[model samples]
Every structure is written in C-alpha cells, then in structure tokens.
Target chain A: PSETHRNAAEARQNTLTKPPGSLGALERIAIQLAALQETERPCADNVQIVLFAGDHGVTAQGISAFPSAVTVEMLRNFASGGAAISVLARKLDARLEVVDAGTLATSEVAGVVTDKPCHGTRDFATTPAMTPDETAFAFDTGRRAVARTVDRGAHLLIFGEMGIGNTTSAAAVAAALLGKAANDLVGAGTGLDSDGIRHKARVIDAALDLHGLKAPDVPAADVLMKVGGLEIAALAGAIVAAAQSRIPVLVDGFIVTAAALAATRLNPSCADWLIYSHRSSEQGHRLILEALDAEPLLDLKMRLGEGSGAAVALSVVRLACALHGEMATFAEAHVSESL
Target chain B: PSETHRNAAEARQNTLTKPPGSLGALERIAIQLAALQETERPCADNVQIVLFAGDHGVTAQGISAFPSAVTVEMLRNFASGGAAISVLARKLDARLEVVDAGTLATSEVAGVVTDKPCHGTRDFATTPAMTPDETAFAFDTGRRAVARTVDRGAHLLIFGEMGIGNTTSAAAVAAALLGKAANDLVGAGTGLDSDGIRHKARVIDAALDLHGLKAPDVPAADVLMKVGGLEIAALAGAIVAAAQSRIPVLVDGFIVTAAALAATRLNPSCADWLIYSHRSSEQGHRLILEALDAEPLLDLKMRLGEGSGAAVALSVVRLACALHGEMATFAEAHVSESL
Candidate 1:
C-alpha cells in the first residue's frame, strides 16, 4: 500500500492537465499525494485548522517582545475572525477551530473552547520537565482534535499555534529533534533586535542544559511528551491520526514543523501525509525543513507564525490539483512540446 | 486635480470587492487609477505589455552571467511563449507584444520584428553617450509602441525589458537617479556570488568615473537620452503615453522603475498614471522605490527582472477590483458587523 499510493500519485501527475513539471514543485506535491491516497481526484475539500493556544513559562523570563496577554488577545482574535489566520482561512475557504490546550488563566473563555489539560507548564530551567502523563495527554489532545475534524469530513488539516514566547519552546523542540545547538536555532521572534535574539538564545540554551535535551531514538510521540508544548503534542497526535485516516496535513511554519517532526518520530508513515507550505524566515525553520527533507512552496520571508503560510499555499495547491485534475495534456491539446 | 485623484483613489479602496487593505498594495494602485480616470468601474480589460529588447554596450564588458545571445534567445522565448514571463502573461490573460528597439544582432529574426535604431550604442565609458538625436528616436520608439497598444484598446500598460547585463545598466541608472554611488546599487544579477558582486561594483564605479556621470537636474527624458537604454527610453515614452491617455501603467521592477524615473524626469505629470508593483529584492529596488515615494504592493523578495512580479500582483489587483465590484456589503448580506 505504501508503494501503491506513491505509484498512483505519479500516474495522476502524468495524466494532469498541464505539461509535466509546468507547475514546478506544486505539481510534484499533487502527484505525490495522488499516489499516497490512490485517487485521481484528490481534493482538500474538507480543510480543517486547529489553533493550539498555550502559555510559555519562559514569557516570564522576557524572551519575547510581546506580553503573554497578546496570546489571549490573539486567541480571541482567531475566534472572532479578526486575526490574520481568520482572514487567511476565509481566503482559502477553510474552516478554523480553536483549542485552548494550556493557558495561565484558570477560567475558560466563552468564545474559545478550553481543552485545557493544565494551566501551563513550569519553566524548564527552573523545574522538572512536564510530567510524562501530561505530555501523553497533550499528544492525545491533538489526536482527539483530529477525530472531531474527521467527524466533520475534514480531509486536509492545518495546525497553527498562538502563544507568546512559544518560539523559545519551538527552538527547544527543534534543537532536540534535529540535535542542533539551541542558540543556532533561536531567532528574533516577533521582531526582536540583536540583543533580544542573544537573550532568547541564552534562555533556550539554559532550558536545553537543565532538561538535558537529546534527540531520541524512540518514537516521535515519546519526544513530544519529553520536551514539547501541549500544542505541539496535540499537533503530533493530529498528524499521526490524519495519516492513519488517509488525510493530508499542511505543516505551517516553525512551531507546526516541530509538531510534525514529533509525529514522524513516532510513526514514519505520517511523513507521507505532510505538505510543507513555506519556509519561514525563522532561524530554526531551515533546519526543520532540512530534517524533514521538505521544500516549501513559497519563500517570501514570511515570519507570521500562524497557519497563514499554509492557508496561502493552499490556494496554489488547490490550483495545482485543479490543473492536474482538469487541464488537457499535450496529447489532448494537440500542441507540440518541442521545447 | 491631484487632490481629486487622490480622494477618488481613497474612495475606490473603500468600494473595492475585498475588505480595506485585504489585497494590500494592489488595492492602492487600482484605487489611485479609479480616481485618476474618475470612474467607478476601473478595468484592466485592455492590458498592454510592451517588451523592449536592447543590447547593452556593457555586454562587451562581460558583466552578465548569461551570454548576450540570451537576449535573442529569450526574445524568441517570449515570441514563442516559453519564458517565465510568457507563461505568467498567459496566466494573467494578458496581451504580450514584443518591441526590438535595439539589439547587437544586425537583422530581424523570423518571428521578431526589427525596430532597431542602432545595432548598439558605443560603449558609454569610451564614448559621448548616445547622441541627443538617437535618444530622442528611442523615446519616440517607445511612444509609438504605446500608441499601438492604445489603438488596440489597452487601458492598462506594463513595460518590460530584456537584455543581458541589463541589471548593470539598471544599477547605473538607479545610482544616477537616486544620487548614490553606482557600487551601492549593483547586486548579483541572475545568481552571481560575492566575487561576482565585487566585480560588478568595481565595474560600475569604473564606468561612472570614466564617463564622469552625474545625476540629471533636468526632466527624466533628457537624463534618459544621456544615459538610458533604448528599451528604457521606449518604456519612459510608454509611461508618458499612459499618463496622457489616463491609463494606469504598472511599473515593474528595477528596470521599469528606472524607466519611470526617466518618464517622471521628463514630465512630472507622468507620475500620475504609475502604479508601483512589488518591491524587488534587487539591490537598487528599495532606493528606486524610495526616490519615487512609491509604496509598492508586494514585498515578496522577488528579483526576477521580467514583468513577472507585476504580472503576479495583477492577480491581486484583479481580486481587489472583483471583490470591490462583486462582494456583498454588510447591508446587502444582511449581516451585522460585529460590535
């Protein structure tokens, strides 16, 4: 079946409306998925987005430019259809659902549903890593979220994170996954200056040392529980579940890539379902992309850490699918491909 | 009158199909033109792309990564619809017409028209620049091209250029226009590395020093006659034509920006019809943009010196116009704007 899906994708690509490689990397992805799902008309019709909100204890350490309250404000923004991601979802004609995995506030907000497993995690340098049980539950949170999406017939999903200082968390997770120096992966999150970047890197290095972070030889699920955010954990679960259910997942920027890395670590087959949308300008993004052996569709130096990149690339993908599924081939068009 | 156009642009932005600023910089351009034409239904229906092909005397200096033969090859590619710009023009459903104002080649090729006023100019460093008469003819060539497009009912225009070592020419033009050293404006065109960059800078400095180049104090036309390319002259003429005809002319990247600089220098009123497309990743693009006080629509780091960036942004403009023209307002949708 592994070989079967890939072969079908190849055949579908060959039969697509446009000339081979005319749409460049986009055509390649459409064909890759066609083979994976073994369908001629692979559609991202049931597109779903999961917004993972969490509080990073490192925010208290002043690693980010924005206050932690911005995360709550942004979560409300996502729910109220006022944020960039909301506009992007509308642009892609996709539905968005928000999940509050772990925020510092105890009471749940009315608009955004609280799937809060805990208020927030303790600072890694100042405490023991999150309990293994909390980690597992976080991963399950993502899986359950995908199950709900599946119930609504969502075949394509996007996992986006909204949290201040989460870039620090992402850097740590990326460092652990790729076995890179934490400082090299740390970048100016939300437009920090050189001094701020230096401070953020130091913070990540401190966390890595205290946590003794290492790339695991075990499953991605284990890795997520060990050093990942509740949001990252949930995304990992969602990725695995989507693959298991034959759904395609478009991985957004740094945070979401960290989640996908965790998922593939658990089940290598999950990589088959992942489509990288764009290369974030973040320092950690290139390394993550390299680890996944994935090439992004666009490189506009976009550092917006939402599912915005994925949502934008979705238009290109949908166009690719339409071109592949709808365009007349050279044989059909009676045009010579002499060049 | 200027205030009227400005206010009309603002009003049109409010009326366009999408939310304000949703189409970003593109909506700004369409609105500006709507105001200029004093019309609500601003259409890009008769879109004209005038491709100006010329041979830079600098090609003899071995400044480009591509051989001068590429100019001819690509002109053929444009004619045959095989180049990236060709594909993009087709994608945008634009009418592309080629003009061979000058080329090193002595005669016309089969598919391309021969409109050369000169085989090529004398090397600028070793000569008294293009004579006033030659520059005037080149400008006239551009005027005639725009007139033909206007006759064909082109309501909007795009000016494009093709020549090996054109970036070298463009950098010199940008430096002169922006009152900066030529070295500051030179960049690695078509993928030159650090070494190539150093050579380019040195070459520009040497050329400017050798020719005793100075920023033009007069209008852009006279400056163009002294220093601009036949293609650039033609483009400047086209921009003048667009202004006179009240057609919105989308200025492309650095080369087109240079042309705009020339047009505005000659006739300040020509600036009224201009729309700055994406800000190119070209080294001089930012400087050119700043000089024009132009707010470009997209900043995608694109340095593909064809009208590709402008072509892509046209989609955004079309979307804005469509949304402005088609989308249901809150009143029409019977939906209350969230308080």
Candidate 2:
C-alpha cells in the first residue's frame, strides 16, 4: 500500500494508449502492476499455461454425472490439442504443458508428457489421503513447472486444472480458505444432480472433521498438505514463483481460483500480480473471489473449469495491454480530455 | 418443414468445418441457413451492419437516465468510429452504414446520410405519433437501405438502432406484439430508477390505450405507424429486405428484437434468416427471446442496445463460420470424432 507507487501507476493510466478505462478490467490490471513493479511501463510478455490433471477418488462416489474415464480421456484431449482450452491456448500463442498431478493412469499417454505425483490420492473419506511429504512434493512440482516456464521466457502465466470431481475438492479448499460451511461452498460441479451435490457436501464436511483444522490461521501449507491436491499445490507454487519473478498471473475459474487462494495464503504479495479472468457459475467461486477482493472480466454463467474462461479472458487482457501500449492519448488524438 | 430440406441441413451440419456443436448458437444459425438457402456451405461473407438513429419524444418524460442528447452524441460517435459497435464492425470486416431515420435535428449532419422519414414524432402517450404515410416512408427507408447494402454485395445483415428512450418504444412494441401487460414488458431503459420504470410502463400503457390496439393482432405496418419509432420501422423494413434478398440477418439486443417482432408479423418467412445475437439483461429481453424460441450466442448481462452485443457475438459467428469452412474434420485430422 505504498501511495507513491500507486499514484505513479494511476498517473500512468492517464498516459496508456487507450481512452480512459477503455480496456476495462485490463486497465485495472496494468495499474496494479504499475504499483507492483514500480514502473511506468509494466510488461507481461512470456505467457505459460499449465494444465494440471488429476483424478479424484470422489469420482468413485458417483458425485459427477460423467464417467471417471473422462478424466484420462480429457487429459489426452488436452495433450492432443483438441479440448477447448487447447484451441484457446493456441489462439493466445501460449505454450501449453500437461502434468499428471495424480491421474489414475499408470504411465504417460502418447501425446502427454507424464510427471505423475502419484497414481492418485487415497480417498478422503477413508484416510488423511496424502502425507505432508507428498503435499510438499506437489508444491515443488508446481515450482518445477514454473522453473520450466521461466526457462522458456514465459513472463505471464495461467494455471488450469482438469479433474472430474475436482469441484468437490475446490469447494473443500474454499471452505478451508473462508471458514464457510461445505454446503454453502459446494455447487453442482459439471452439472451434478441435487442428490449428488448433497452427498459431495457431506463428504467434504466429513473430511474437514477428520482433518480437525477448521480455522483460517491453521497454517496454509499444513491445511493444503492435509487436504489439497498435487495439482492445486503445483498451481500454488506456480503462483508464488510468478510473484517472485515479477510476472503477472492470470487466474481462471473455480479450480484455478482455489489454487490461487492456497497460493495467496502462502505468500500474501502473490495477490498483487493476479488478474481474475471470470466470475464462474460454480457456487464456491463467489466466496473465493470475494476472499481475494478480485474483480473478474466476464461472467457468462460458465462452470466449465478447464481454464477456457481464462484463455478467452486472456485475449481481452492482451487487447487491454495492446490498447494501453498502442492507443493515442487525448493529446495525441486531439480530442477533448475528460480528465 | 420439408423433411428433405431439414435432413439436408442436418447433413450439412455434419460436414461443417468445426465440430457439430462447438460453435454453439452459431451452429444453429448456420444450420438454419443451410435449410433456408438449401446449401451445404452457409456463408455470411458479405456482412452489412445497418444502424438506425432517431430521437424518441418520450425522452421528455424522463424514462431514461441517459439524456436525449446522447442520441445525437452517440450518432457522432458511431460516424466518427469511436463506439463499441464501430470497433466491432471494423474487427469483423463488416461494412457499417448509419441512417438518420428520424432525429430531433431537422437539418442533415456531416458524414451521416439522411434516411429521414420525419423530423420526429409527437410523444406516443398523446396519440398515434406518426401517420401511416410516415410509417410507410420509414419502412421504405429500411427497404431502400437494404437494397443499397445488397448493391454493395452484402449477403449477411446486422440490424442496430441508436435512439434514447427507444427502449420505452420497444417495450410498448413488445407488449403489443406479445399481448402482454406494459409492466411485464417495461424495464429500466438506459438505467432508470423504480419511479422511472413505473412511469415507463404507464407511458407505454397510455400509448396503447390512445391507439386502441390492446390485443396482438395489429398488422406489423400498423404497429409501426402507431407505436414504433421511425428507426424501428426502418429496422422492420431492413428485416423484410434481408428476407427478400435471402440474406441471413443477425438481430441485436432488445430494441432490435422488437423490430424483428414487427417484421415477423408482416411475413413469417422473415424468421428463417434471423439470428438472435445475445439476450440483453433488460427485463423484456428474456420474454422476447422465449417468445421467438431463439437462443442467443452470449449472455454477459449487457443492456447496451446499440448492437454492441450483436457485434461482439459476431466475432464468435465469424470464428464459427471460419472454422466450419476452414478446419479439417476428424477424419482429416486423424482425431476421434464426436463432441
């Protein structure tokens, strides 16, 4: 909250290429970055999109309408560049890499590069699921992914995940982050029926009871290690790494937001570089968005948590930056100035 | 419906360059045209966006938050290419033409063509504002404008309007078209308070009472003469001309929808080429959408009715058509088929 830096950013906003507030949320993003980098020209050039694939044991609980096979099938889809996110990444000219945070599949599929954190976690209903070491490794996996992105000159990063019952996991993470009830945080993920939703909420509440960590100050890393996925931990690492590198991170829908919440908990300054992509239709998304005081670009009632929303919104961000960098100011355009 | 024609369109849908349903609402548009034009390859190559600018006398009633001057100011904005629709038109490579159907200004404005049917109409709450001759002239203005677009090689059309307080006119038109109550059809036009909304409904009801056209059976042309603005008449005529030319038309938000309703009453076949762009957040938009049984491309809670939604959605349509016309099929990509 340095007023000097914030004022400089605000002044730069008057000079960015476009009309005042023409870029909408993107203008706000650049202004925030101006304050963070303490520079007039804040740039986010290298862009990386990380797809974390995982399989939830809750899929066995029949909480999702789609068969669990969709998880692996979609992983192949993401790898082969056929999923919506794949086309979107190509549209944005971003390098897309897939990591097996914990898919049920044993080995790497033909198109996908495999780095299995584990074959999948133990079912949360039965046990603590993953030990602290596994969780730290997951976070390190994300850090490694960031290292790869930084190596490739990706200055801007977007983290996305694909898992069938990941919404249940996302809701639990949101509950842990906000101290909200599981029922309030849970939603019909990927179009779940009422009964399935009820069961998913119950499962989350039961898992929380087993963990016995119900408060916000329970140490973010410890909470994540006990209940978060390898993909979520990796996403957190990527976020933290992006902050450390001074690269702005564009956060996608529910699952990515959950990852962001976990990351912000670890390093509070990480929030400064983050630009929320959309307000998702997922129930837990509002709580997570509110927790971050994040304003999203689009809200199309989309609950598809494959980072497609982020990908679409990324084009808007790029357009914002381009406008900020490209548009003529009032003086240049010779138009009457409102300010 | 002809079974052969329906089946032929279905077969065309199977062959479009993109996935069967990946284009979403654009797929419906393409298929509807495939059935209408009886072609396997549906093209919107020659696209034209016609903007009808007018001034509503009801502005004196204070139904809208934006002043009446915004009508002329935005007209200048459109002509000078500063508005959202202007940018969208440029992005889509679509030709933009503005028609001064009726404005408060009696004289011509620079860089804007005069398609004026009249200088302006009396406030609708007083009486049938425009005579049948004036309405005919307004409708003829649209028809002539469409001919000009066709002359310019436009095979696809978009209908947009720019008139402050037109939403009041639109709600009355919708109430008349659907036989609904005024309150049900009226909404906060250009952002209004509760009092403004109630006044709008009352004004619409009073206009309906003055005309003695309570039920829905009023002829489309009659409706135009009675309750519609000159721009509304122009829009209705544009739809007719697009239908006559067999060119597909993409309809903008609520006001344009009301225009389509007016056109459809004249000739039911006009609906064949009509594509609803997006449902506006305006209260009456959903009812109009449902009544038409039409699905829009995007839903971003936008109520800016200067065809901005339609223009934004056009990018998606162009993308869909481009993908449908350009991309290889699964058989060609050696990828598994099926969305």
Candidate 3:
C-alpha cells in the first residue's frame, strides 16, 4: 500500500463538506482504497468476481446438508446466469469467471475454466483432504485467475466458492488455526439442525485428531493441504495474488474468510489488502473475523456463499469512493466547519 | 403493506436457488419492498430525496458544534451541487429537492423550494420552539413536498435535514415521547467534547421539565410543538404523507428517526411505509431506533443527516430488488434444493 496516497486521501476526506468522521466507515474505506490502488481518487468500478467450484470428499461423512452433486450442478447454474453470484456479477457490472478446481464432474461445464487436479479431495475424516501437489496446483489456478483479471485492468476482486461439505472443511481449518475445539467453531451451514450440527462437529474433531497439523508448530500450509477444500485453497491463493498486484480483495462469509485466515497465515503482508464484507449467520465467522481483527462492512446475517455477501457490499465501497472523489470541499461550498 | 404481495414475495424468495432464509436481511428487505409496493417485483428506482434545511432557535443556547449560518449556506450548497446530499443524489440517480422549511435567510436560495413558515423557531429553553399554528403549517409544507414527488412518479422517498443545533431538538423530542431523562438521549451533535455534551444534556433536561411533556400520555404533537425544529416536524409530515400516497419512505439517521417516532404517534399506520436506512454514530440514535422497532439496512456508524445515510443505502436496496426480480429460481436453474 502507498502511504503517500493514503495520507493524501485521508486529508481529502477531512476537507469534504461534512463533519469530521461523520461518514464513519465510508471515509475509512475510501482512504484505504486510495492507499491500496496508489491513487488519490480511488474507485472499485471495475471489479472482478472469480468463483472457484469444487467437491468436498468430507460429504461422505454426512457433514453437509446438501448432496455433493449439487456442487457440479451449481456450476451449470452459474454459467446459465441463474445463480446468486451470476445475478450479482451482472448487477454489479463485474467480470466473472468460474474455475473448476477439483469438482467430481468428468466433463467440463460450459463457461467454466477447467483446472481440476483431481476429481475431489480425499475425505479428511480419515485422511488428508488433498495431496501436496494437488494443493499447489489449486493455489496456482487461483493465482492465474487473478492475473487474468489484472490483464483486463480490474480495480477490485471478490473470490467466491461453490463446494458441498466445504463448511466442514472451513470449520476444521479455523479450529486448527485458532487452537479451539471443533464444537466451538461448528455451526449450521445451509440449514443444519442441532443433531446435524453435533454430528458435524464430531466429524471435524475426529479429522483434526487424525491430522498432526492440529499442533501449534504445524505450518499453515500443511493445515490447508490436510483439511481445506480445493476452492478454499484457491481463494487463499487469489487473496495473496491480489495483494501482490495491489488490487484490494473483499473477503466473503465463513468459508472465504477461513481461506483468508489461511492466506494471512501464509502471507501476513497480504492482510492490509483484505476488506471484510459481512458477518454471516454462521456462528464461526465471528471468531475468524476477530482473529484477523477485521470489522466487516455489513452484517445482514447472511450466510449464503458464492461471494454473495461481498458482491452486495461492493455497492457500499463504490459509494464511498464516489463520495470521496466527488463531494465538494467546505471552502468550495462556503459552509462553516465544526467549531 | 399488502399482505398478499408480501406473502407471495416471501414464497418467491424461498424458491430462489439458496437455502431458506440464507439471504437474511436482504431477503427480508426484498419481501418488505414487495409488500410496500403492492407488487411481486419491487424496485426503489425513481426515489425522491427531499432535504429540509432549517435553523434551530435552540442554537441560541449554544447547543450545536457548528454555526447556525451553516443551515442556510448548506441549502445553497445543496442547490449548487456541493453538499454531501447533492453528490449522493446524483450518484444514486434520485431526484433531489431542497426545502427552505424555516431557515433564517431573508430570501430563497436559487433552485431551492421556499416553504419558510417562519424565519426560525424560538429558543425552547425559555419558550416553545413553535406556535401551534406554525407547527401545523410546517407539517403541511412537508405533506405538500411528498405530494409533488407522487406527481413525478416516485417509488420511494428519503427525508434529510439540515439544521444547526437540531440534535438538541431531536434529543428533547425523543426524551418526551419515550419518557426518559435528557442525559439518556443526548450525545455529541457534530463534534462536541464531553463537557459540551453534558451542557447540552442539562439544557434539554431543564427544558423538558419546564414543558411537562416528559411523561407518558402527553400528546406527541405537543412534544413537537414545544421542542422540535421546523425540519423535524416537516420530516414527520412527509413520512405520514408518503404512507398516505403509498410510496415507501427510506428514513435517515437520528434527527429523521425522531421525526418518524413522532409521525408514528400521530398516525400509527405510517410505520408500515417506513424502511430504516442506517444507524448513526450519534449515541441516542439506537434508543430511538429501538423505540421505532426499526432494524436499519446499513450501519456504517454514519451520522451525517442530509439523507446521506439513506442515499448510501439506496444502492443496497436497489441491488436487493434487482436480485429478487432478476435471479432465476431453483426450478428455472434446474438445481437441487436443500434437503
């Protein structure tokens, strides 16, 4: 981030025709964007939404409420512009691309980029979710996806994911990073009842116990390979790559945030470029967000994935940029400043 | 609100390709808009922003952080497209009309609608803010403003206020209606120190005690006449008038919420037409929002009262409407629903 541009933007915000700090988070967002983009007048106008889709082998442990096939089917929905992210991408005027990281589908879906290293990861309840090579391959796919957006002059990026049983993967990843029990991090994902939640928690606990990465000395990368899904790793890769390119990333709900936690662990410098979008209805998201010391932009209690939360918050960010760049100064308006 | 439309919209939201209630407040917002618009597809496009600018007699008590001259100057700022609300209206593509509700200006500013019932209200510390007749006239001026918007085919209404020391008026009005002490509802207006806040609270308490409206069953109208500013009463009138005309109102921060509380007391039916846009950084805003049973859309801690909060939130509401009306349903997408 450019400190000079950030300081300049902060000064500009104070000069606008409103009370100091009255616009609250909006003012901070503009200054931060200016710093990240290295421009006095920052904007999120040309955002790129890259959605990573995969299938989680953990579904075999009855961890998810939905069937695994739904993951492959939703990719078709995204391609057809019938999915939430599809509609949001169109509405937000964002460039969206789908990446098939490790879904079970044999053939490629139309409009989805095929970079599958495997059909899916192994069930983490009994074994590591992905081999080291597959983990590296999925991460590179995400990095390449963001590089493509930079080629098109994208200003901001939002990473979305479509994977069944991914919430279990997210829970296990968070538990490992935070040094907590599975019960503390597990919550209903896509409508699980109390019994289902308990069962899911037990599955996560067993998986963590099975993997030696649960220890404090374990590298964050090992945790991702052992427990995280392909899309989650891809999201982590995208976040780091966006930071490297100086394009700000808006992190979505529980699943994407878990990837963000991993990204921050892998590359702590990337933390400055990540903007949290919302607190989801999922109970574990708050813990992950607090761990990152992030105060999210919105909290409409939304828990749907596919980057919907971040896509919705893009409007607020764009508005902040507009206000920062367009509003007249107090001197120009001939209005008195605060006494 | 039309219950039939609301129910149908609720059903439609559930049928979308997401888990039931996974969209959370966005879904509720869309459903509420449908009910308020009395249609299956609700859009907040064609919104009318009526910014009421006035000077408060309470400024005589030195209760504000800014000078009273700002009230009139901001009207010019609004007209010349220099103020916060001016930029917001242009960005949202909403119609903006400024009302000289009761500013101290001798003549009208160019392009501002003149409805000055008086030069300004009297200092309520020693006397009632307005005579009964002036209060009625200011309210009618607000009613007329909404009527004009209806003629132009507005689908939603946003009320913003510009008044120096109006926070004192708003705090006093809220204390009267909610039957609370002044300190419980007083905060920094623009940028007051702790000492200034204490001084403001003392003034409000003394004024409320002198007026005898700090008890339950005291008419809400009497509270407005005694302590409310011209812009506050006008906002209340506009809210009720908008409900009568069947256009939904997106209410701004503290000052406007106090007006909404008064409007609800005067006509409980108007509450259904109101959609809260945000919670403000002002300390007392939460109490008033709770009294109104309102859960606002965005809470960026914004306290700028030029309908700016509502204007910023307009993009979120518009996005919600678009997602609701345009997204393909589960049946249309051929995707499996949650088991």
Candidate 4:
C-alpha cells in the first residue's frame, strides 16, 4: 500500500462536509483506491469484466442442476448480451470479455476467446481434474488476459466464472485448503434440492480421498490440478497477475472467491488487491468469505455467478470515486467542522 | 399493496433467467414497486430527494459536535450542489429539493423552499420541542411538498434531514416509541467524542422523562410535538402522505428511520410503502430498523443523513426496475430451468 497516498486520502476525508468517517465503507474505499492507484485522486472510469468459462468434469457425478453443455451455452448468452453479466456489464458500462479456458464444447462463439489447454478435466471423483502442465497453461491464459486488459487502460478488473458443476469443484478445492469435510463446504449449485446437496457432498468427499490432498499443506498448483476447474485456475492466475500489475481485482461470488483463496495461497500479497463484491446466498459462500476475512460490499442474497455481484457493486465503487473526487471540502463549502 | 400487480410481478420474477427467489431484495423491491405503482411494469425513472433542514434547540446542551448554524449552511451547500447528497442527486439524475422546514436562520436561500412552521423547535431538554399545532403544520409542509413532487411526475420519494443535534431528538423520540432507555438509543452525532455521547444520552433520557411517554401508547403526533425536530416531523408527515398517495418511500439513515418509526406508528400500513435505503452505522439505527423490521437495500455503514444513502441506493433500485422490465424471460432466452 502507498502510505503517502492513503494518508492524503484520509486527510481529505476528514475535510469533507460530513463528519469524519461518516461515509463508512465509501471513505475506506476511497483511501484504498488512493493507495492502490498511488494517487491522491483515484478514478474507476475504465472497468473491465473478464469472464472465465470452462466445463467441470465433475458434472459426470450428476451433482449440478444444469447440464455441462450450459457452460458453453452461457458463453453464447454472454456474447449475445443475454446473460445476467451481460446486462450488468452494459448497465455498468464495463467492457466484457468472455474467455473460454477449457470447455467440452467446441469454441465457435464470435466474441469468446478460445484458449483451452484441454477439452476439459478428468472427472475428479475418479481421477485428478487437470494435468499439472495444463493447470499452468490455464493460469498463464488468465495472466495474459489481465495483462491485455491493463494494457488497454483498464484500472479495475472483475473476475467471474461460468462452469456447470463448478461449485462442486470449488468446494473440493476449498475442502482441501480448509482441511474440512465436504459436508462442511458443499452446497446446492444451480438450484439443487436437499438430496442433490447430499449427492454433491459425497462426490466432493470421494474426489478429496481420491486425490489425497490436505489443507494448508498441498501446493496451490497441485490443488488446482487435482480438484479445480480450468476457469478457477485462470481466475486465480488473473487475480495474482492483476496484483502484480498493480490493478485492483473485484471478486464476484463463491466460485470466484474459491479462486481468490487459491490466489492468496499462492501469493499472500494478492489478497491486498482483492475487493469482495457481495456475500452470495449460496451456503458455503459465508465460509469462503470468512476464510479470507473478507467484508463484501453488498449482501443482497444473490447467488448467481457470472460476475453479476461485482458488476452490481461497480456502481458503489464508482460512486466512491466520484464522491472522493467531486465533493467540496469544508473550506470550499464553508461548512462548520466539529468543535 | 396492489395484490394484482404484485402477483404479476412475482410471476414475472419466477420466469427470469435466475432461479426463483434468487435476486433476493431486488426481487422484493420490484414486486413492492409494482404493488405501490399498481403497474405491471414498474419504473423508478422519476426520482426525487426531498431534504428537510431545520435547527434544534438541543444544541444548547452541547450534544452535537457541530453548531446548529451548520444546518442552514449545508442547505446552501445542497442548493449549490456541493454536498454529498447534491453530488449523488446529479449522479442519479434525480431532482433535489431543499426545504427550510424550521431552521433558526432566515430562509433566503435561492433554491430552498423556505417553508418553516417556526424558526426552530424549542429545546425538549427543558420543555416540548413543538406545540401540537406547530407539529401539525410541519406535517402538512411535508405532505404538501411530497404531493407537489408527485404532481410533477415523481414516482419515488427519498426523505433525508439536515439538523445539528437532531440525533439527540431522534433518540428521544425512539426511546419513547421503543420503550427503551435513552442510552440504548443515543449515538454520537457528527463526530462527538465518548463524553459527548454520554451527555447526549443523559439529555435524551431527561427529555423522555419530561414527556412522560411510555411505549405502544404514545400517540404519533404527541411524540412528534414532544421531542421531534421540525424537519423530522416533516419527514414523518411526508412518509405518511407518500404512502397515502401510493408513492414509494426510500428511507435514509438513523434520523430518517426515527421519523419512519413515528410514521408507522401513525399508520402501520405505511411500512408497506417504505423501502429502507441502507443501514446506518449510528448506534441506534439498528434498533430503529429492528423495530420497523426493515431490510435495507445496502449496509454501507453510512450515516451522513442527507438522503445520501437513499440516493446511493437509487441506482440499485433503478437497475432492479430495468432488469424487471427489460430482461428476457426463460422462454425468450432459451435458458434451461432446474428440474
């Protein structure tokens, strides 16, 4: 963090018309942005939403409500401005990039960037999801995507994922990292019923036992190869790369947070660059947020992925910047200060 | 609530791309707007923020950090577009109306309504803050202000207040309504140190004792006359009148919620027309929200209290309307539904 810029922002906050710290998270957000941007005045004018799409081999377990084909279908929905994220991206005026890291379906969508290292991962219930080399390749794909956006003058990056049954994979990854049983971290993905949740948990538990991965001891890369989906690996890569590039990352819902967990585990410094967007209504999202010690910006009980939460929260982030840059100081407004 | 329109909206929500009840508060807001507006397609396009400014005699007790004169000063700042709410009004493209309900200063500001029932409320620390007639007039001022805006095409109303030392009066009113001690409902207003908060609590406790108000029995008008500021009284009146007029009310922070509490006491049905904007970090705000059973749209810890939270939340409300009205249904999007 840039202490000088943060100090300057804090000093400016005290001089605003309202009482000191009255703006709450907005005041903190301004200071954080100042520190991240290394400037007294921070702007979030150029925002980009990078959506990573992949297919989860764990779908073979029949855990998710939707079919794996829905992953590629949603990519087309995103490109055609029919998905939730597409609507939000237009509403927020953010550039939307759909990256197909790896999907079972062939990539022929017009706007989606196809850069898969594998068609999909092996079903983790029986075997590791991805080879180590393929995991690294997915990570590099994420890094390069962020680098390209930063080169295009994007100051803020929002990461979202689209993968059927990806939440099961995220749970498996989280279970390994937190050293918890699958029952503790598993949840209904894409509107699962009670029975579906039990089935999902069993699948995750079997995957963990199959891979012999344990929390806090397994390397992040190995965990990604063993249980993570291609989109999750890419998201982790994007988060780390964004931090390395000094660009802030706005993390979406549960799946994105699992990627953040992996990113922070790989490099603790990446956590500093992450801005949690909202608390998803998905059951295990709270555990992921608690694990990261994250305070999300909103909690509207939204559980839909596709960076929708981050896109919805982008307005608050922009308003924070606007208030920081535009509101008159007490001296300028001639308003009285605290006695 | 219009059951017909609400039923229509609920049906539409189930058909949206996400799962049933997935959008959380956004879904509820859309349904509420439909019921209040009595339209199949609700719109929050014409939004107005009515900020009531007044002075409080309790400033003589040293309860607040800022002077009462700052109320009038901030009115000028609001008019000149230099305040937090002013910037937010511009950003949200909402109309801003500053009402000089009862500030001590002479109302010569160009854009302010200058409709004071009196110069200011009498200090309730010694006696009733307002006479019954004066309280009635303040309510009428609020009623007519909202009526004129509705006549001018405002579909949504946001109520905010500007008054130094008003938090003490709000606490006093809340204590009477909630059957709580003053300390339980008092907070540091505008950067008061710990000692000031204790002093403010004592003042409110004394006022509650002076009024001889017991919970669940105190009449709304009597409570307003006993402890409410002219601006808060006006806000209460506006809320009641807005509900009568079938316009949705987007309520602001602590002081505004106190007014809402009073309004709900006057007519319990008004709560149906109210939408809480955000949860204030102010100490007593949670109590007031709990009393109202309010589920605020945002929890930014904001306590600026000039309808700033309401204005900030307007974006989300607007987006909810847009998504409700614009998004393609499951059939239109050809998205698969959960089995």
Most DockQ-accurate candidate: 3
Candidate 2 per-residue C-alpha lDDT over B98-160 given as tens digits, one digit per residue, 9 for 90 to 100: 888998766776767788867776688876768988888889889988988777866568988
Each model's fnat? 0.00, 0.01, 0.82, 0.59
lDDT tens digits by residue: candidate 4, A24-131: 998888889899999998888799999999998888889888877777767777888877788788878899999999988664678899888988888999988999
What value does the lDDT take at residue A299 in candidate 2?
65
Candidates 2 and 4: which is better by lDDT? 4
The best-first sequence of candidates by DockQ reads: 3, 4, 2, 1
What are the TM values for chain B, all candidates?
A: 0.91, 0.92, 0.99, 0.97
| Model 3 C-alpha lDDT per residue in residues A81-200, reported as the tens digit of each score | 988899899988998899999999999999999987899899998899999999999899889998888888888899999898998999999999999889988989988999999999
Encode model 1's per-residue lDDT on B92-168: one tens digit a residue.
67888788888776767666656768966656655534778878888888888877777787767888887767788
The count of residue-pair clashes in candidate 3 stands at 0
* lDDT of candidate 3 over B248-338, digit per residue (tens): 9999999999999999999999999999999998999999999889999988989889999999889999888988898888889888887
DockQ of each: 0.07, 0.12, 0.83, 0.68
Give stretches of model 1 more than 4 Å off.
Answer: A1-22, A214-223, B1-339
C-alpha TM-scores of all predictions: 0.62, 0.77, 0.99, 0.97
Residue A203 displacement (Å), model 4: 1.5
Instruction: In model 2, state the lDDT of residue A135.
Output: 81
Q: Is candidate 1 or candidate 4 better by TM-score?
A: 4
RMSD (Cα, Å) for all candidates, in order, is 8.5, 5.6, 1.0, 1.5
**Candidate maximizing TM-score:** 3
